[model samples]
Target: MSSVVDSTCEIREAQLALQRDGEELEHVEFTINSLYAEIEVIPKGNCLLQEKRHAVQSRIFTNSARISPVRSLPTEILQRIFKVCLPDDRYVTPDIRSVPLLLCQICRRWREVAEASSELWSSIAVYDLSDKGSYTAMVTRWLVASHHRPLAVSLSCRDAIIFHEFPLAPVLRWWSHTQHFITFVYTATISGLLD
Candidate 1:
């Protein structure tokens, strides 16, 4: 009779354990289903979040630029600052890599300030006018930017042929017509001519 009772108790324990395992399995399946549902909605939600973030970033950038100290500077002060940036060589060439031209390329406001500041354009050096048309146009533009200020010009040539071909008549005519005081310097280095 004791053996029969022991067998009955063991059978009852096994049934209870099987019921608990079934309940645990159902809970795990429900959790997996919930996760799948969330994954389906995540992409659209993520896109909306990204768009909001971008808008906020753009507003911050615009507001920061608007309140910048550089933008607050007066035109006269800015022009003075620009003058200090000019090269010490006294005569500037129209190279985009250099000060005056580089300043103009920065922004519209700087371009306006640099172009309007006659002092920055007062002295220019023209090197080897092999590109005659472009050089003339550039020289003309530089002179115009000088406005009524006194001008200093330097012309340098390495080859005699190119020097002779340089279109100087138009430049001379323009200078004669201007009321501003002008100083012109010409330098030529031919292999044998100087010796």
Candidate 2:
């Protein structure tokens, strides 16, 4: 084999490589410090931004809350409002003048509250006790509307009224819980109403 001699070139090449590596190390150190400083500032800046965002959101929520007049009302006041919407008489139907029916029509919440309320349906007035289908249905509905609460019934009939023949079965069924309060006496037909 022939002897090779490249030691001198090899040494020079090694020294040049060392010099470049030293410069690269210094540049890397500088870049690392710059990045560290930026990293520290970014979190603080983000924290301030977040604080501003939350403050603005809070102000917007407060302003929105101030706009609702009914939302701020207490539960007691809301209950009173519901009570005022009830009719003076106890028995009611879907007539426009019927308070319970009207209140139920206004909203879902009103319907729930009205239907469950015993006081609102405690007073019922029966204009007639005839065996006619509609009148019997109305009387039955009024009794059911009371919902186990004590009832005040007003019974009156214009013509000759008879107890056994009249639609008094449902009323008599609830007689234990009912009190006949008002009686409109006619000429000759409503004797069995109070009984």
Candidate 3:
């Protein structure tokens, strides 16, 4: 489970890195092309053209050399990077997995990193999911790797009152012992409100 979470985290970082770098590359290319075109038509003694060209060239070189700072990130920095990968919300309907929690999508190394870093994936938020079996499994992995650290969980109204999510019963039973750690959201029902 740890390995699964780790890989998922790294893969997520890779994908975001690719998207960000790709955009920067495109912007740089466009600026360079526009400058080069203007330089061709500039008059012989144009100081503006010379300065613009120099600036563009400098930026091009700087950006080219820097594919991404993450490429050479230290271990502490990398862990920090993974921390943001975890989204505050967990149950987003179709996407069961959180952004930072999906490092397996990036590559093998990231997957390993995420798995090894239990804290990265220990946070959980309950919403509409009916089954807790899978969650229990995930919790176990997190519990073991979390080194006795308490896990963070957000309790939402839907999951607060034992919504008949069949899977939840087993999980509740399993965690009947550690119920205090998780946050459960609750709202007043019509009957409760009336009363």
Estimate TM-scores for all models. Answer: 0.60, 0.42, 0.40
Candidate ordering by TM-score (highest first): 1, 2, 3
- lDDT of prediction 2: 0.63
Kindly list the per-residue Cα lDDT of model 3 for residues 55-146, writing each as its tens digit.
99999977875776555666666677787766555422113265444664565556667666655745655444444577545555444444
Candidate 2 per-residue lDDT, tens place, 1-195, comes to 122347767778899999999999999999999999999999999999999999999999878866867656665665577677776654443243466545656555566666677666666666655556765665565556566676666665555444445555564564544444333222336555566
lDDT of 1 by residue, 1-195 (tens): 999999999999999998999999999999999999999999989999999999999999889888889998999999999999988886888776776777878778889999998889889898856675866666667777777888888878777776666656754665674466577887776774555
Whole-model lDDT per candidate: 0.81, 0.63, 0.58
Instruction: Name the lDDT value of residue 14 in candidate 3.
Output: 100
Among residues 3 or more apart in sequence or in different chains, the pairs in candidate 2 whose N, CA or C atoms overlap within 3 Å are 90-123
User: By lDDT, who's the top model here?
Assistant: 1
Ranked by TM-score, the better of candidates 1 and 2 is 1
Q: Rank the candidates by lDDT, best first.
A: 1, 2, 3
**C-alpha lDDT of candidate 1 relative to the true structure:** 0.81
